[model samples]
Target: MMLTCIAVDDEPLALRLIANFIEQTPFLQLVGSYSSAAAALRGLQQQTTAVDVLFLDIQMPDLNGLELARVLDKGPGTDKPRVVFTTAFNQYALEGYKVDALDYLLKPFDYAEFRRVADKALAYANATRPTAAEPALLPQEDYLYLKVEYQLVRVDFRDILYIEGLKDYVKVYRQSEARPLLSLSSLKSLEERLPARQFMRIHRSFIIALNQVKSVSRSTVQIGSATIPVSDRHREAFDQFLSRWK
Candidate 1:
């Protein structure tokens, strides 16, 4: 399968070069190329098709590549792309891997060097993709098990107040609980399991139980004492839910 990819760089020359490489590659399809990290973020969030790979330059003006990668990783999507960092300095290589980067390409890299990393990304994409025999989503259930530290804790859907995403972990706040139950999972992962009618992701960091919401404003959702902001990206869906309730 051709891996769908995007390249982001502040320098026009660098961005053009990366775009050229992506177009020339047989297994890679260049979907979009952005001159800034912010533009890339917006494009990825709104795009309907899932991107398999991201070719990013580490240093940029407002939002750097590493920061952008983290945002995409924790953002409201299940198909998080494999990142390949491109930078002039090799110093950022260690930080790149912390965000689970597929590979690092130092600046002034030739077409041969770029192709090697592209090969690595292709191999990874092939390995992780789900086969026809393996279903992506399982049958929905009332309660789901979460890994809290070393123990597996079960949380019921009806009892859940809301869920918070912090980097790689999620905090599940349930009814009558003073402290939330922490789990080693992404909001996107949990989102897939939760019943759509009962829960809604109001923000990048929060997923609220629809039935438990006390009130909702133009930009926020109230659940008990906690108020969750409805992100601009998710506002339309939140508005639609309000219309349905009306």
Candidate 2:
């Protein structure tokens, strides 16, 4: 059966590329391409059709993929499509898992691996919906443990947006109504501690949630209309991340 899919990414090129790839892949039928999570939700809400898989990019302007996944779970559909996250960073892997994502692809992943992951997701998307007795229907938890005030804290993985360097201190952005920017210790030092799957070093200064960003191109990441520069050193990985979207 053709697995119907809708890809949501921030880059126009990435969306076009996925569309092209869908055309060639017999198992996947391209349902739509959305430049932002908001756009995808609008179309999906129109109640026009059903999709089997989601090729989702994490970071976006209005609604990021993780949040979008949570939204989809509440939709009228009895069962939701399998979600596969496409991102450049590795730090958010645990969080993606928390969102019940089928798989997480690091930026610049090999095309062969992508196909492999896609195949698995297709099978899951087509599997029988969880029955009331099945625990798979429960919301999965993704969190990072932290020691604060003589106690351990279980922070929901998706609460973070960015963690900034502050000499010796680290500030974590948590579940605030608005996206939070945090202060943190040395960027390099913190990078070592982050989960390799969910976080990536896009620049010497910034550690973005692999699933939080909206989109990217050769030059910049779209933060609003402003373009955030992609460091020359990170170009290769960034290009690879962008290629899958293509």
Best by TM-score: 1
Q: What global local distance difference test value does model 2 have? A: 0.67
User: Model 1 over residues 5-96: C-alpha lDDT tens digits?
Assistant: 99999999999999999999999999999999999999998889999999999899999999999898777756899888889998876576
Which segments of model 2 are wrong by more than 4 Å? 129-246
- Model 2 lDDT per residue over 1-246, tens place: 577888889988767766766676778888878999999888777636677778899988889988999888656645477787888777877566545567776666566766877676555533333445553222342554443321234456576665655564455555453544333235786676567566666776666666666777677775433345779998898787777687
C-alpha RMSD for every candidate: 11.3, 19.9
Candidates' C-alpha lDDT: 0.85, 0.67
Model 1 clash pairs? none
Error of 2 at 46 (Å): 1.8
Lowest-scoring 10 consecutive residues by lDDT in candidate 1?
133-142
